[model samples]
Target: QIVRAGAPYYLPAKIAEHVSMVGELLQFPRLVPKKVISVGSPVKWANSCDARGCANLVTPSVIAQRYKLPDESLPAAHQAHTSNSMAVAEFQGQFWKKSDLDGFGTSCHRDVSVAKTIGDEEPHGGIESELDIEYIKAVAPEIPLTVIYNGQFSLLKWANQISSMADP
Candidate 1:
């Protein structure tokens, strides 16, 4: 399962909380590192100082090639990376309206259409950047693999909480 936090950019701390909650509810293994994919903006990192933002710097092609994928496979990987960059640009242009850091004040709605679009673009990291689907197809050819994107509600809630706490 590709476990990602609910949106609009859920804080790391709250995501931890949700993970714990879900783990407890399902009696699943507590905090397995391999199962989680932190696709949240890398801007939260202390080392990145670039102004172009997180999406621009994320070259999935470079990453895919790093995995030793063949040269012919590079084109699709590049396409996926370019598509992801475009999607991010569109999202920021359309959604990020307020100049203030905390523009949406309260909880923000998840754009399901956009999320589905991104999923449809298949930005998974593999030979063709369609790794997730391709992997499942190869391993369990008959079984249907469904990609579920958890909305960013918990993320937005956590961000609001953080902003509120910072307002001292």
Candidate 2:
């Protein structure tokens, strides 16, 4: 039996009255980091499972050749970015690493920082940012991408900005 003053089992009137849950260990939630998989250029089909599986990886060059786009188009994957910005950029956007657009197979990413520091939370560790960055970069390799992070989005300010842009 637990004889501690604060343990659930410990229920002495005087001790319980004085200490609700003092001297107890704090149990923080477990943060099981996700296993990073499928990074960099794609791999060709593996001849056998024995060897690291190859194949199935498709890069910009592969996509270009397959679709037969003009050579001038380096990535020639996704549509060009307009003045407003791509749908992905409307929100937090993507930022796994600051590096330029790089994806599997015939693509490149510039080395840089893409995320911001919020409170004690480290930047560039979000699954949303990672996924968005990877896929968007894969399709729009040529487009310049930026990430603007903030503790508060200021919905009122955003609304005002949008309203101001509307036919004044």
Local accuracy by lDDT, each model: 0.30, 0.41
Would you estimate the TM-scores of all the predictions?
0.19, 0.32
**Candidate 2 lDDT:** 0.41
| Candidate 1 lDDT for residue 39 | 71
Best by TM-score: 2
- Compared to the true structure, candidate 2 yields what TM-score? 0.32
Q: Per-residue lDDT tens digits of candidate 2, residues 58-160?
A: 4333454566655534455444556523323223432344332233222332222232222222344456765555555444444554543433455444444
Number of clashes in every candidate structure? 6, 16
Candidate 1 per-residue lDDT over residues 37-154, each given as its tens digit: 7677544222122234434342323333345644433354223332222122111112221221121111111111112222122222222223333332222222323332222334
